[model samples]
Target: MSTETDPVRLSFRDVCARRLEWHGLARPSAGSRPADVARAMAGVHAQVISGAELGVGLRIAGATRTDVRAALWGDHSLIKTFGPRGTVHLLPSDDLPLWVAALSAVPPPREGFPEDVRMTPEQTEKVLAAIAEALQDGELTIDELNDEVIHRAGSWAGDLVMPAFQGKWARWRQAVHLAGMRGVLCFGPNRGRKITYTHPGRWSPGFEPAETLPALAHVVKSYLRAYGPATPQRFAHWLNAPARWAADLFASLAGDLQQVEVEGIAAWVVAGDTAVPAPVTPSVRLLPYFDTYAYRVGNQPPGLLYPGRARDRVLRGNFQALIVDGVVAGLWHQRRSGGRVDLTVEPLVRLDAAQRDELGVQAERVGEILEAKPRLTIGTVTVGGHA
Candidate 1:
């Protein structure tokens, strides 16, 4: 009676716990790329192991960045691997090749666009060629890069001087697409001059050859084993690929995944593992913008958290989320003044004192993770409540 649309749900707590188990049991002891390992161990975005704020929340499940890097490369080397959508992500030392093969060659942008909607190939090339040349030896800051991009495109660049660099899809997506093609810039660093696009060979010297499809198959198998009882759609969402492609990928790696009935629907569960551990007790946590918990699934299931509210908050694009007991309780934002960070939480429900306290602690950790060192304040503003 379970339909594919009605997936048997796993709580946020369960997802976090499973992430911990995978990090501890499956991650390589040494020489694994920090980014890939971060993605596989804690879902992409490196939220679980971001910065020095480890051993807290779901992130504590993973090893320290130093320990993780040392384990993978025999040296401490964690560089910004920013590519694809121009967002920085982490990469593992040993698994870069697998990620490259799986990701670098994204099928040419789904064609059939209205003509003159964006830039032509020649214009895109001119802009990207300038960028690659500019960033050939080193990185640039956001301001520097934006100016460079504007200069490169010249009169044909179009009007990109909007509120948030919008109108520049031609430059933005093209840069990311080219970076993806090169296979470096996997994830990135946001230090002083946080401009992305760099040569991987130059940035990360002495890397081992990336793994083959069999290895990628193993990694996918490991992903299911750790985060199983999940759907192909969910897997695809997490991996950022088309669901059908994910389905084919799953089918190709036979015997590694098992079909299980969840809420009466057929879903894939990790096959090798014999144990189904009870999830940790549900608790409130504040996730950052574009957290893995919010964007990791192949398809978005609003009912699990926001219900009718999903469309308003979680659009097709990424957004930060508020998680309660493994469900997205609502969305939150931060305002900074002096050394204090105002944690403004706009929840879909009324929060009790314990939940408020929990939110405060998590917010403090978030500030610390971002190196803001701000005093935490938790205040609830009631929004439209469901009857």
Candidate 2:
């Protein structure tokens, strides 16, 4: 363990490159499975499921969207559920116990909704129980699940409280994420165009939540291993937890953490894992929106990761990123029409001929993963940000 008094110092460039290597970006992992990529990424953000598939597909050599889908619905190697920040993610099914324990322990934000819109603790618990019971037997569309929850819990559970896209959502709907973290709820195969939810126990037989402290420790170490030389504040932001709570959590894990300075910024890494590799040569990758690598850079000193115009174009807007040599160098977008994908890359930095060629190769890889013919264009991407 490293002490605050004598922390290891590292350059931002070295830290960025090390993170890329850990993410399977500096060198994509050959013959790795979808679950392997998901595990290395901690979890792939899955608000947009296709984006999640692309994120995992890009990290593993010869991997495709079909393989990712098969891993989720066929092989049962990946589980789609609420992960860090209470967002949908594709996680290794075997690690669900650890993920659930750690996520369930995070105290919900105090002032998330107005008093009228929020569910009382008792109501929340009851709704979660109802959800567990509803999903125990088989998969159910949201509508079916909602009716079952209302029937099992009470009429109060059906009262429209939380405002959604246009109208209010039922009171029980707020507990969806909570149920997922409690290890009772997860995404099931889609019923045609509609999505379904099922009990994790259905697919992960004999599944049980792990002990909280040890699981949390494992999660913290996993984060550090994947995106370390990071501060508790960044971890808190990534997890959507309170900064003070994360700081206290970091303090409790002092024996397992090493203090480090990244370009003079104080951070922590898993103990005994501080060897930085030699600087990597420039590489190009087109990451889909909500890609783990694109999102986990976590409020670093502005120019280090999001250089020049990229801060506004990529980071602030949450646009698909064009990465060059482990930094966000531009924005990219893809439009699919029939069997073809038109890729538009808006580079903030001038690309040399070699870099342009590499971008073309990366675009082709994206096409292969999606099983579409790709046309690469290096120019402005006029599309708006995705949700």
Off by over 4 Å in 2: 292-303
| TM-score of candidate 1 versus the correct structure, residues matched by position | 0.66
Candidate models: Cα lDDT each:
0.51, 0.86
- The residue-level lDDT of candidate 1 at 279 comes to 45
Candidate 2: C-alpha lDDT:
0.86
Q: For residues 188-275, what per-residue lDDT tens digits would candidate 1 score against the true structure? A: 3445535344545555566433545664575566456545657767866665557687677778767666665544456676654434
Q: What's the TM-score of every candidate structure?
A: 0.66, 0.96
Indicate which candidate wins on lDDT. Answer: 2
Q: How many pairs of residues collide in model 1?
A: 32
Clashes (backbone N, CA, C under 3 Å), per candidate, total 32, 0
Clash pairs, model 2 backbone: none
With candidate 1 superimposed using the best TM-score fit, by how many Å does residue 236's alpha carbon deviate from the native?
3.6
Model 1 off-target regions past 4 Å? Answer: 1-37, 40-43, 46-58, 61-79, 82-88, 112-136, 140-175, 186-196, 207-212, 222-227, 237-242, 292-300, 308-319, 350-357, 371-387
